[model samples]
Target: MSSKDEKNLTQVTDKISAMDEPRRSTMQRVHDVIMTAAPALKPRIWYGMPAYAASASAPALITLRNDERINLALTEKAPFRAAGGVDGQLMPAAWYLEDLDDATETRVAEIVRSVVG
Candidate 1:
């Protein structure tokens, strides 16, 4: 990793480590799930959060905030078409979802597989 990327990762890890129990647990759960599912992926800090992708060479599929929310940025036209009428209104490659549940977790794993596999 570049020196800048290492610094960013350090910042994100520190921020996540400082979160309260609920938020920290949530972030750790999501991080664990992603790491388990994609053993080859690399993690980095992006937008003040923990982000994982197939590699720094690939696009990020998951980003977890210290506030215990997971952010999924949709990069394909399919997600926009599948968004239906969500409040965020899909915008090609700019869709993001927060505060996911168990079902959301499954859905996220599917999305990650599709994107990174």
Candidate 2:
């Protein structure tokens, strides 16, 4: 990672640490799952939210959004495809989570490993 990226990752981590309640804990776990599953993905902040990318300044592979629920979005440009309902003929861009259970973590890890390979 570049110096800029390292700085940004630190900034992103700080932001995650500062978040309130479930979002904070959820994002941290998501961060860990992605990093552990795919060490090649670099953590950063995108649009003021936590995101992971294939490289410095690249578009996010997955992003954590604190909406009505926690959202783990797989970018359209990402390597592996996600299965879900269609949106005007296009697949939905992400997976939503109310909580990170063990099953969810395992599935997320499996996706990350497949994509990062």
User: Mind giving the per-residue lDDT tens digits that candidate 2 earns over 1-117?
Assistant: 779778978987898899898789988898899889988888888888888888887888778888788888877667644454653445545778878899999988887776667
| TM-score, predicted candidate 2 vs. hidden true structure | 0.83
Q: Which regions of candidate 2 deviate over 4 angstroms?
A: 80-92
TM-score of each: 0.58, 0.83
Q: Which ten residues in a row have the lowest lDDT in candidate 2?
A: 80-89
Worst lDDT run of 10 residues, candidate 1, spans 74-83
lDDT of each: 0.59, 0.81
